[model samples]
Target: MESEIDRFPVKSLMERYSITRSVLYKRLKGLGIVPTKFGRQSYVTGKELTLLDQLHDPNCNPRDVNRWRVD
Candidate 1:
């Protein structure tokens, strides 16, 4: 992603990830993520996409996350 590319549409992202609207919002919200607020057009940043990837990644481990630290 580049500085010029600020965000991605939530619907397209949902389609790519096979996520439902409620699931997408719930997951993103739980991870402290939010989209840019506009009139009838919400969108998430590239940073959010990266974060989402990390959270949903098959290779991610419980110990890899600082917030969910494990002994």
Candidate 2:
């Protein structure tokens, strides 16, 4: 049993952070992470983000983060 964090849309992030689309794009670029696009929009995988965060710390690279890509 584990808690699941959901994926967030680009527009949702823009509104939540009170930032423009360009700013969001810039931040993503600065972070060196690219999202996987599904359908006609872009999306950030919450699991991937968490995994990256853990990996970024250099001392906590976890073996797995819960996520399944349906295709």
Candidate 3:
């Protein structure tokens, strides 16, 4: 059987990235990332977090998540 992938809560991501809910949602939408819902809460997979990190700009402000680019 395949091992379960690590999951992170959206609230934790907000704290980790220092972004607001709207900003996080916008960033996720821009990046074509869809959060997995569990009951009333939302979560992101480790793979998705990696993708976010890969696209993240260290120099840019955390709130400026739009600065992240795929290309």
Q: Using TM-score as the measure, which candidate wins?
A: 1
lDDT of 2: 0.58
Q: Lowest lDDT 10-mer window, candidate 2?
A: 62-71
The TM-score of predicted model 1 comes to 0.68
Candidate 1: list runs displaced more than 4 Å: 1-4, 61-71
Tell me how far the alpha carbon of residue 50 in candidate 1 is from the true structure, in angstroms, after superposition.
0.7
Q: Across residues 1-71, which tens digit of lDDT does each residue of candidate 1 receive?
A: 64655788777767877878887876666666767766788887777777777867878763444463112
At residue 4, give the lDDT of candidate 2.
72
What TM-score would each prediction reach against the true structure?
Answer: 0.68, 0.57, 0.67
User: What is the C-alpha lDDT profile of model 2 across 11-40, one tens digit per residue?
Assistant: 676676566888766656655557777898
In Å, residue 33's CA in model 2 sits off its true spot by 1.6
Top candidate by lDDT: 3
Better of 1 and 3 by TM-score: 1
lDDT of 3 by residue, 1-71 (tens): 88765888877877887878888887788767788999988888887787676545676465555555343
Note each model's CA RMSD in angstroms: 4.9, 8.1, 4.7
Summed backbone clashes in each candidate are: 0, 0, 0
Winner by TM-score between candidate 3 and candidate 2: 3
